[model samples]
Target: MGGFATGLARVTTATILASSALPWPQPWHSAGNAQARGSGRPITSGPNFFTAEEFAMVRQLCERIYPQDEEGPGADGLGVPLFIDGQLSTPYGYGARWYMHGPFVAGPPEAGYQLPYAPRQLYRLALERLNAFCLENWQKPFVQLSEEVQVDLLTWLEKDALSLGPVPGNVFFELLRANTLEGVFSDPIHGGNHLMKSWYLTGFPGARADFMDWINQEGAAYPFGPVSIPVLPHKRDEQG
Candidate 1:
């Protein structure tokens, strides 16, 4: 549960640019010239409990995962943390889609998440448990711990060596980490893939009408690798 699934591992140079088997929704347009809906959105920055805490935690964690560098846009630039928050605010995060009905037993490895807890519960317990462990081991809460301590804490949780709770620490880490990558790469319509840094990393072209004219051209490097600018509502029919 902590590591990758068998046969699921495919390390490639391009994650976003690679041909995906994921059934992502089709690209949609942003509302016209409207300012970003900074309001009316449930913040997912920290834990789902308090708005300020969630925001701080997510922002900090995201920056750690994708630090600003000469490479490209960072996680914050891509708005990954915000996307994570948005996702959690939905039924998906609350475990509405999960099989919470009990007679719950620890089943075989293949059974997967047989327990009744959802993301919110799992995180709530995990956070509290991790904080407690931190108080004993490092004398600080998970968020307050220094960067080095954070790594140590993360490592322990990822390894499932942290005896915080039965929340499946390793499984939780992998889930959160994978989703974090999604937020880093998925279409912005889904609210992650902000500046499209993941696309740049993997050399994938995005939603464009055609590559026919450039296909036959040889030798010369294509003028553009494969860029996908936002296709807002006004640009929708332009494809046809």
Candidate 2:
């Protein structure tokens, strides 16, 4: 992951530098501010994976994971749910990239994912069972629960104390947590981070061409605002 992170930074630097050399439309941005001009645009696509009820649940879950505070926008507002949905519609969601065939061993914690369900299936089953459990206990769906109750339920999920049908609660919680972070921080071109709000919050120069000169400045605030990979329809499809 560290290697990947370093590589991504390098790629970002190269791409941004090359793009800057070309005549391209650059979205105006400012440094040290969480908000960027023309960023944080509203997500336009409808859910391709989750139904309305489930999508609502996902939205709530994601926002709860990274709620709106004095810092900046929360997950749903940043399209984290939509990002997960978009991811589910791709090969990644189907687990096409993984070696699904198994000797089926759960030897230790060090061993990786041994679940039978694909990522898409896990989401569907988890949401359905969670809603059922919530209704049984609280007379409502998880999405309809109050924020306090929702937080309690999420805690139970984190502790693996909740049973949601065939899907392990802890596994679901882990997946949701990971996906939430990915959606919040990943490039907006991948259907999350809606306008690079998180980048701005973290002082990440998203796609800004040249920051080589500023690399030596430690503990100093970035002067140029973050940039992003401009979304082109074909590129989106290709990446997904």
Candidate 3:
């Protein structure tokens, strides 16, 4: 959305999201350079909020969403659940400067979020609701529940059966699930994208400085950017 209005300078230009008159990207950026190396630091909240059991549950949920396979690494490998924890610790966790004022109404799918609760609130409420449902129905915490029970809970949320207070279950599901994917794929500068697996899959050359020469060359192998980092903690080699 941000790029669409600016029109990619080479072809033309139009500013999108005039909310800020600043340039399309901030000056601190590596710009279009793919050499950007992620320090892989967490940006959101720390180990707070998540009890050990809750964290294990999150890991399990993420693994279910993107299981490990020969095709590529899974959500756990990318540190998505950890990324979620960090996001909840950030200002975004407090609802920040967003337009939280609302005479709320349920709208079409495209109407987007109308609630005031921030991500931290969402997680807090959702996890409680999930645990309540688990205890009421299964007599155990979510983390201790069987994989099938976990799937059932997630399915209920996806289908809007497990309603949390204030926030809609589907809304929480979408927000949490979408954030999970975004962190899994985002430029590592912000956090997540542990090993650039998303870039590798999409052939995204990543934040390269000089696509000027290579873009549109059609099917050229991405240089693997000299900044490649191991996607997993165990695979990480500062030298390799």
Which has the greatest TM-score?
A: 2
Q: Evaluate residue 110 in candidate 1 and report its C-alpha lDDT on the 0 to 100 scale.
A: 88
**Deviation from native of the Cα of residue 139 in model 2, angstroms:** 1.1
TM-score of each: 0.68, 0.79, 0.70
Encode model 3's per-residue lDDT on 98-195: one tens digit a residue. 77887878788888777767778778777777777778887887778876666666667779987876767888777767776667666664456665
Q: Which regions in candidate 3 have their CA more than 4 angstroms from the true location?
A: 1-39, 42-46, 108-110, 216-218, 226-240
- What is the Cα-based lDDT of residue 203 in candidate 2? 52
lDDT of each: 0.57, 0.73, 0.60
Please count the clashing residue pairs in each candidate, in the order shown. Answer: 6, 3, 13
- Cα displacement (angstroms), candidate 2, residue 96, comes to 0.5
Put down candidate 1 lDDT per residue, 1-240, tens digits, no spaces.
212211121232244246543222222122321232211122233334436654566565565555454445556666777787667778988898778898888788788887677776665566667667777887865678776656555666678776667777786676666666777667655566654445544545555578787675654343443334455654444322
Q: Regarding TM-score, does 1 or 3 come out ahead?
A: 3
Native-to-model Cα distance after best TM-score fit, residue 104 in candidate 3, in Å: 3.6
